[model samples]
Target: MNRAAQAVVMFLLGGAVLRITWTDVYLRYVKQGLRPFLIAAGLLLVVAAAMTLVYEVRDIVRHRGHPAHDDGHGHGRSGQLVGWLLLLPALALLAITPPALGADTAARSGSALATVGESETAFSPLPPGDPVKLTLIEYGYRAVFDGGRTLRGRQVQLTGFIATGPDGRPILARIMLACCAADGIPIKIGLRGDVPDLAPDTWVRATGQWIPHTVKDPVNDSEIPYLEVAAWLKIDPPANQYD
Candidate 1:
């Protein structure tokens, strides 16, 4: 495509910066292809801009010597217009710059907001009402590793995703993974009362007491009670999206 078109495309795609910087979606799926993809896109934008400039300059020179061809707009008006159009992409990027994905949203959004390898495993189980500093991944792992024993009737704060149970109850979930968020498996705590009406992708803070539970799963031989949440509040999503 011409320079103006190229510039517009770049602006639209620039939004991908948010995904790359925060979400693991591309890193996990595209893997080695990322660098090449960026390089190619960058090169295309640069070349388009260069062509637009060159054409504009040529038109200026051609019109300068010929009065018969001269319009009020001067030489190379079309090329200059195209060049100005190229600025649209840059302007679009400026207008809609990607917002930072804050780390705080981990509680409300899915485990996709946690940063892989950044998770903490040092969280020792605390007595109810204790101020526990726990990351999303650790909270998820412990809830699973301990088989809900650690969370029995304990007031704990956790950030993660919202998932639905077989009974159609909304659950506060976090996913654990060996790689990226895509591979992350979800674990959830059932929330009591009417949930805060948070949307599927929204991040929020959950402050409540944890109640350990055991439910008979017809599909499984053993009974399991996922963690039960006593109260929850909506808040922003965390900066990262994996762990």
Candidate 2:
């Protein structure tokens, strides 16, 4: 690819990065903590692209009357085509922002819960509240590792998209991201009691007590805990889908 083409591609990629990081769109792919780094990296790319274009233009002006000579590294039409193909990712980022991970991803992953290590068995007392809010991962840890000892006699609230269990029962689920969507793992809680039938990926806020009973995940044999939902309400998906 020519230097000009390379500069254009860099600019497009940098602009795409800045666009997503400037809004909540980035939260769908990465943790909130990484926003500043992404912004800095985008700015660097843009600056580098701008500098490159300036040098290319200066060189053209300096040699306007001279005969052109091919650089040893120059690739023919085939290489230019391949270089242009690299723009698709940048263009897609600019034109189409994909939706956050949802039930389909969770279901396809077999709804397996992440295993708690033996050294991580420590439990903390639930904070004082009528319906204590908890992430799906936190709820899972307490229910599976501690046997809901910290959850008994307390009504807890969990917010996540609904996913269907192996038995076709609705389960409350959220994607847990260690870094980004590529490394996301689904944490699911079985919904019992009088929970309403909801379609997969329907975001909801569930308030319930831990059922103290755990069922084995058919795919991985990881214990999936149950929630005796007292009440639930449909809600829009949160700004950040991962927990």
Candidate 3:
């Protein structure tokens, strides 16, 4: 492709990156800590593109009176076509932002139970609250690996999308990302009592007590914990889907 076209592509790609970052859409694919780095990279690309475009315009103006000549390579058409193809990713990002990873991703990966070290087995007493809010990962760890030692006799709240368990029952599930969606692992908790018949990917806030029983995840053979859901309601998906 010509230098002008290359500059345009760079600008589009950079703009796409900036747009997502500005709107907090990047949280779907990456951790919050990477926001600054993404913003910087996007700005760099945009600046470089602008500089290249200015240089190209200056060169064109300087040579406006010269007769055009072409080397017999005849590669311009093919190169332009390839350049157009490269614009699709940028266009997609700008026009059709993809939804965050949800039930389908979680089901395929299976339940991921965090391994508790010997030191981790002795969990601290939970803070006093009628129903303390906890992340799905924390509840899963306490329920399965720690045998609900800290969760017993306590009501806790969890918010996550729903996914079907190995037994085809609804489970509250969240995707835990180490760095990005590509490295996400699903943490699932089986719902024992009065789970509503909701479609997969439906986000919910549930207040439940630990059931103190573990079930085997057929996909990965890891222990899956159960929560006796006392109350639950549908909720909008959070801005950041990953934990």
Off by over 4 Å in 3: 71-74, 114-120
**Higher-TM-score candidate of 1 and 3:** 3
Between which residue pairs do clashes occur in model 2?
A: none
lDDT (CA) for every model shown?
Answer: 0.50, 0.88, 0.88
lDDT of 2 at 191: 91
What is the lDDT, from 0 to 100, of the residue 16 in candidate 3? Answer: 94
Q: For each candidate, what TM-score against the reference? A: 0.44, 0.94, 0.92
Query: Where does candidate 3 have its weakest 10-residue lDDT segment?
Result: 114-123
Off by over 4 Å in 1: 1-129, 147-149, 215-225
lDDT of 3 by residue, 9-111 (tens): 9999999999999997899879988999999989998999999999999999999999978867887777789887979989988888778888887788867
Off by over 4 Å in 2: 72-74, 110-112, 117-120
For candidate 1, the 10 contiguous residues with the lowest summed lDDT are: 216-225
Model 2 lDDT, full chain set: 0.88
Comparing 1 with 2 on lDDT, the higher-scoring candidate is 2
C-alpha root-mean-square deviation, candidate 3: 1.9
Pairwise lDDT winner, candidates 1 and 3: 3
Local accuracy of candidate 2 as per-residue lDDT tens digits, 1-243: 889999999999999999999999999889999999999989998999999999999999999999998887856899899999989999998889899998887777755465757654759899997899998888998888887889999999999999988678899899888899998878889999868688899999999999868877776778789999999999999999998
Instruction: Give every collision pair in model 3.
Output: none
